[model samples]
Target: MNLWGRINTLRNQIFLGFMFVMVLVLAAVGLFNYEQVSVLLRSNAEKHIQQTAVQATGKLDVLLRQIDTFTAQVATNANIQRLLMQEADGRPINFEERQLLQQEVRKHEAYTTGIRSIELYTTEYRRLLPLADDTLESRVPDEWISRVDEGKGRLIWLGLDPRYPDVVIAIRHVRLIDRSFSHAGYVMVQIDKSYFELMNAESAADNDRAAREYMGLVDESGQIISSDFPSDIEAAALISRQETISLDGKKYFAVQKQSDTTGWKIIILTPVDYATEGIAVLRTAIIVSVMVGGLLFLILTFILSVMITRPILNLIKAMRNARFGTLKPIPVTSATMEINELNHTYNQMVVSLNELIEVVYQKEIIQSRTELKALQAQINPHFLFNTLEAFYWALDEKGEEELSEIVVAMSGLFRYVISRADEDEWVTVGDELEHAERYLKIMDMRMLDRLSWRIEADDASRCVPIPKLLIQPLVENAILHGVEQRVGQGTVVLRAEPSGRKGYTRIVVTDDGPGMNEDKIRELYAAMESGQNDSAKGNGIGLANVERRLRLYYEAGTNGLNIRSEEAKGTTIAFEIPGEQGRD
Candidate 1:
């Protein structure tokens, strides 16, 4: 339901593919938009921090100007000037004058907050006066005194007041009205640090807490003047010019501006995580949307793929069944038009193919019958051959025993050949041997002591059926071509036994006579291979026909004749037939 799982099936894979494409597109668009937004957000964050620093600096400028105005007012006060300028016979001022000067300084001190006190140092009188309650008289360092003396009338920041470290002092070398900017006495103003601290506190409070921001102020020497940040952060901010930097391996965004009044840098530090928090939220939203969309897409893709594939799968099943001779028309149920058309075409092909098969089968039957009748017509020579048998028996009745025996054998041979005229007829090896024996007898009388024959067949072989007259033609060939032309008596052997090849009987008709040369044997083999029955005198009854018929009956070339001959030696011709004894 959540879309994460194995995609092993076709529908699952298709669904996964759709989901994958969805994810890719969403990721591409999301990442691109996120990148752009992130850049804009980050840029805005930097500019915001910079503007915040500038605003803080503006606030600090106001406070610094107030301090400057306060210092200027005190230095120009008439009572304080007159008390410091009055010389009482080169001695310090009396208590009454001092009290009057203190009252004037108090007026200036009242205008500022957290001012510990105001004092006047008259080097000409060597007198220090403190102008407020809780104002202790302490020895001021000569460094501070000399700096104030060197300032002429310009105010000088004396760093932090040592006795009141929380306060900063500003001083101006006071000038008398003697037309001289000489070192008269110095007017010093003490301002509390809480003013600057308040400025920073207010600036940080204005920003959101999630921003994790803090501010710092650094002098021109990169020394911290006022801020709430840690020392390390302040140090890092002082040196860093980048809008963003890593603090202790964590990212931070920093921006700074220099105060026009104090020449101090105001820096704000915000965690990068805080700045890009919006981007993270946006990215999460985008991912969630993509997941939901992808799930919906996957469901839709699965449904569509199933709709498309189901009919095609059925068609495939039907086609597969067709391979095993199932030529039935496939049922048309495809939803798609093209697939339905394909199924229809397939159905037509099945019908046409079945029809063609039937037509071919019928034609083959007719051809077989025609061929059978043709062979029967050829065997119909039985009439003349049978008439010759009448003559043969008639001669036998005349009591010429040798002639009578020959005639009887000829009659039996003719009967055997005529009985087997039908091509479908099959005879056992023993019956075929008997037929060959009768033909040999006839040939023996014709050759007149020039031919002799023997038939050697195993009992098991004798029952094995073969095409009728399968051996007779080879026997006739042996006598006529092998013995009839020889000067002395030649022997013909008819052998039937279990062939060396399994499941077959080997029939060899060998003749010992003036053997043929290799050339004549080659010519006979060539004619047999070509299936051409050359009507040459040496090839009696055409050995090619006997070879072709043997091959056809057994349906194997190895079952056909093989002739082996040598000049002046002998010729051995052999063939094989099925070992089945029944007349199949």
Candidate 2:
């Protein structure tokens, strides 16, 4: 072949094979560099956030513990202990003794000068000797005095300073143990919230000059306890939850630190951008290196003149014959006798191998279909046994009379779910509701007295068509997870109220069980959407499957399912399906 023809031939095979190989090399190097740089930056951001969270919390705890310890010690003091009992027993202190006790309280508060700003709350109850210019109105309310008297020592971290709104802070009440200490009412210590915010921000601000960061001390409720940006601070209080809150387009990695002294949580926020600043430079360098390397390889392939032969032309012709019709024995009558003979023999062997390959392909397809049916079969038997057990429970636990009513309802429900009668999609709402009631009866047997349920359906909604066996799975999830585990008695209410357009129906399902937190509920919905097995930890795949079927079968009826839940409270599951049914 001529030189230009040879170069053109290279384009016909795998895009000049060398360029294809070079692209793969470039992609691999780019991916490796991206991963390493990305991981290092993410790790640094995470560790710095964790470190600052632990440190700021540690200092805050030290400060809080100092107050608690001092308060407890003050409670046990001889004068205060005696005074508390006298007040509890309704006895008045003598004038000579009252003078000595007040002098001692003043001496003790001097030692706590660094820890708290002492404020005298009452004229009759007690006095902060040094801070007292004149007797002031009682800051310790009668309600607080009553709480201490009732023997409630639990100190809660109150979020808002009843008096101060702009300041981010926390507070707690300590019941003085001494008789006079109790009579003194309670002690109020003022803490500086800024001390914590400044200390926390310092550690995360270690790297780049322009990268900005914010520090927040939030309670377990996801409420900001001491943050300059109280509105921006998201609290993950009762549960140690963490989420990224983007502000002005910057990502802040927030870590939660729960305090031991007080039930407050300290969250430290750091800028993720600062940690990965070096990765951008590394990415550019890798791109440049790959381009230079690819050019060098193309030059080498051209110089080598890797074999171009007429012998391969005969081989290509044989390949075309095998594809176009029944495999033919290659021609051997050529001037190049040796090359033609080899091609003929190679063609004959390919005919035998191709026939064998066809046989294996057919067998594998049949086996795969069989295995799929077997998996479907597996789901039914477990379902059968579980159903039988539930019936047995209904009879024994709630009495035989309720059993007959449940059985008749369930028999009709099962007939519809298992039938192959309707090939045309779409079943009535009444049909889906019958299925849902059957599932609820099973759970009602288990919960017995603790279970109660209600279903409301408008006459208009019952005529609306829904995908077969849709509502049953969702009801099963609502009871099994929502109500069954709840401590107190539970209630599940399902409503099929008519909503939106004339033919549309809004179906809602809710339960009062041991509720789930926001994180867990989102996790529940996300897992179902992805078709993952969430059953291991109280997640059921049924709801997700039903959702997929609805979206696929019903072209544009409703957008999606809505799941809302709270921890130890309950959950609400709702979806809007058009009153008119099927995958239209």
Q: Which portions of model 1 miss their true places by more than 4 Å? A: 1-32, 88-91, 131-150, 177-182, 198-208, 220-223, 231-249, 276-584
- What lDDT tens digits, residue by residue, belong to model 2 across residues 263-289? 666665566676446654465656765
**Candidate 2 lDDT for residue 436:** 78
| lDDT (tens digit, per residue) of candidate 1 on 333-423 | 6435566679889889889999999999999999999999987776356677777778777887787788878777877776776554345
Model 2 bad stretches (over 4 Å)? 1-400, 421-425, 501-503, 536-541, 555-557, 581-584
TM-score, structure 1 vs. true: 0.38
Identify the candidate with maximal lDDT. 1
Please give the lDDT score at residue 175 for candidate 1: 72
Any residue pairs clashing in model 1, and if so which?
A: none
